[model samples]
Every structure is written in structure tokens, then in C-alpha cells.
Target: MLHKGEAINIAPNVVHWHGASHDSRFTHIAINPNVSQGGAVIWGQPVTDDEYNASRS
Candidate 1:
């Protein structure tokens, strides 16, 4: 997860994801430029149940 003042730049044709610890919190801000004619930030698919379960530490 992103911390305070942290940022992620998802470039074109790029697929990325992040998450927090199972017992912690996760938070982030996504910005798209295409959506505003600059570029697009598309949130593709949701994390599958198996993916989340695998991420637990």
C-alpha cells in the first residue's frame, strides 16, 4: 500500500497492483490523464479471491 505522500505512476500499457498486510490497512490514490484528455487511468480487474488469499502473510 501507499504511505502518506507516496505516489505511483502507471504508464501506458502497464498493469500494476498493490495491497496492505492482512492485519493492516491499505490505501491509495489513482490518477488518470487520458480520462481528462491527458491520458487514461483504467482500473481493469478486481483482485480474485484466490489472489487475496495468497497475499495474506
Candidate 2:
């Protein structure tokens, strides 16, 4: 897990999901660069209960 002052870079076309923890509050910055195709970001579906619970393990 990423602690305070740490950062992670998500490359283009990569699939990733993140959000606030159930027991803590935090903030983060996500920057997606515009590619030659003119697309910068592609959002996916919301996180389901099963998905979130499984990830916590």
C-alpha cells in the first residue's frame, strides 16, 4: 500500500482501480496524458461490493 507522500504512475492502456479506504480518508492526484489518438482517459464501471471486499484481502 502507498503511504503518505508516495506516488504511483499508471501507464496508458493499463487497467487500475482505487478509492478511499473503509477506515481512512485520503486524497490523491490522477493525471492522464493525452495521446496521439486524442483520448486521455477511459473510465470503467463502479466498484462492486464483492470486488472491494476481495481486494481488501
Candidate 3:
């Protein structure tokens, strides 16, 4: 999870995901401005079985 001071830059039209390790708790807040016309959140692909299995502590 992202702590108080940590930040991430998500580019436009890019698909990505982030979360804490399985053994730990994860929490984060997303802030989006509504001024843009295409202001909406979209979810793409789900985590693959292989990807989940490859995650490390």
C-alpha cells in the first residue's frame, strides 16, 4: 500500500494495478478531477493466475 508520503504517476490510457503484498494490508485513495470531459474510471484486465502466483512477499 502507499504510505502517507508515497505517490504514483498513472499515465493517460494506460492500464495498471497496485496493491500491498498478500500478507499485508493495503489501502489507498484515488483523486480524480471532474473538469475533463472524459472523466471516468475504467477497469481493464484482471490479475492473471500466473501473475498472482508470482507475487513475492
Candidate 4:
């Protein structure tokens, strides 16, 4: 589980997702540089609570 004041770094072009645990709050800042060089952000399907909880297991 992640604790407060912790952060994760995702490299460019990596397929990943993240969020806060239940009964908690999550906040983040995203930095996308070099967008004009064909960089893009593609969103996938939403993660259900079942999926999130399963990962915690």
C-alpha cells in the first residue's frame, strides 16, 4: 500500500494507471513535455472497484 507524501514516476509510453485506496484521498500532478514531438496521452477503460480491490489482495 502507498503512504502519504509518496509518489511514483511513470516513464514515457508506459501503459499504467494509479489511484488512491478506499477511505483515502489521492492527488497528483502530471507533467507532459515534448508533446509537439508526437507525444500523446491515451486513456483506457475505467478501473472498477473490483479491479482495484483485487490488486490490493
Best candidate, TM-score: 2
Q: Candidate 3: deviation at residue 50, Å?
A: 9.0
* Residue-wise C-alpha lDDT for candidate 4, range 1-57, written one tens digit per residue: 678887787888799877676656678677778679877678789988897677467
Predicted model with the maximum lDDT: 4
Q: Write the per-residue lDDT of candidate 3 for residues 11-50, one digit (tens) a residue.
A: 6677787766556666766777753878567976877766
Clashes of each: 3, 0, 0, 0
Per-model TM-score, in order, reads: 0.54, 0.64, 0.55, 0.61
Ranking the candidates on TM-score from highest down gives: 2, 4, 3, 1
Give, for candidate 4, the lowest lDDT window spanning 10 residues. Answer: 17-26
Higher-ranked by lDDT: 1 or 2: 2
Kindly report which residue pairs in candidate 1 clash with one another.
33-39, 34-39, 34-40
lDDT of each: 0.68, 0.75, 0.70, 0.76
Residue 16 in candidate 2, Cα distance off native in Å: 0.5
Model 2 TM-score (2 dp): 0.64
Question: Candidate 3's error at 42, in angstroms?
Answer: 0.2
Pull out the clashing pairs in model 3. none
Off by over 4 Å in 4: 1-3, 49-57
Task: List, residue by residue over 2-46, the lDDT tens digit for candidate 2.
Answer: 788988888777888878666666686876556566766778898
Model 1 lowest lDDT segment of ten: 33-42
Residues 1-57, candidate 1: write the lDDT tens digits: 356777777668787777764566777666664676756665668877777777574
**After superposition, candidate 2 runs with Cα above 4 Å error:** 35-37, 48-57
